[model samples]
Target: MTDHIDGALALSWMNTFTEDFHAAQQALTDLDRQAGDGDFGTNIASALRKVVAELPTADDATFASVFTATANGFLATGGTSGPLFGMWFRAVSRSTATEGTDTDLLAQGVAAGLAKVQTLGGASVGDNTMIDALAPASQALLDASTGGLTVDKALTSAARAARAGAASTADLLAARGRASYVGDLALGVEDPGAVTVAIFFEAGAAALSA
Candidate 1:
């Protein structure tokens, strides 16, 4: 009955996300090649590498600190998605500007992050952007929190929803982002940003489960 994710757990989540992204980097780049400039995976890998280098120790870590480091890492990276993700994590940092966060609070942070991403990126759920995964994941977190699920279950639910949303992007004609530039040529290709969002939630779930 872990009721909250403390600084240590939050740090672990970021590390896991970094590892997961590294493993998926080649695949993500290939996916992006179908609809974008094909540098998506390399760019994100660069950002995560910076994030890992800047990660605070568990003893010094707080939700705000961890998220802020992540935000800064992404912000320093080049490209549209990188900066958008930076702002998204920045909002999450603001929401969880404390030592720890319960599932309900985490949900609020994720929802706030989603809102910031949407505002900054000007993309919506069906736009075949990262919002495709982020929007559903945000809603899933809110639902899980309201339903009184444990932290692990709540994160798992969000991860599931995010994966589904990312998968859906494969069938979509991109309405925004780099994929949009390719028009129907991206019909069978999943947006790399959306898949990355799913990976983020999945890493969160795995981090808490461990």
Candidate 2:
């Protein structure tokens, strides 16, 4: 019943994102085949399933607990992306407190998460990684938080930014992770990581609006 980006909303977003991921799992699998080991969809889906199982009920969950569950779940999964996502979520969990209903705190957690992803992956925007989608989405959330907008508006902006960022990755050369092994051959295909990030932001937006 959460209407914003609180711990409850995070759980709602995960459910929505997982459903969306399942719908696009085949496409994700195909995209990964071009640049990675063809297991990105499977890995992310598996991680989400574990996260859902580990997390407490929405009413019982705290912001920190939500992210902590996500981090642990992603870490338990197999693949290079798993550890990178684990680091991002862990940083977010560490940044979060037990409180809820503060846009600034959510923004801070996302900023912290982005920083961890950058540091761990040694990636920046346009790196043909999840960072590409995450960076712009975080910036959008920050802007919305600074502007004193509603969480739904902020998440909508973030989702849009993520989509645009992911689309842009279609032309980027892989600069990190397993995708980097493919070099320029990754051209003309969106990075699967970025696409998944976009879906997550989209789910967040939908959850907050609901």
Best of the candidates, lDDT: 1
Tens-digit lDDT track of model 2 for 93-202: 76555555456666787888898888878999978899899999999989988898777788888899999999999999988878889888889989999999999889
TM-score of 2: 0.92
Candidate 1 lDDT score relative to the true structure: 0.89
Q: Against the true structure, what is each candidate's TM-score?
A: 0.96, 0.92
lDDT string for model 1 (47-157, tens) is: 988888888998899888899999999999998888989988887777663557887888998898888888877888788899999999999989988899987899999
Off by over 4 Å in 1: 97-99
> In candidate 1, what residue range of length 10 has the lowest lDDT sum?
91-100
TM-score of 1: 0.96
Clashing residue pairs in all predictions, respectively, total 0, 0
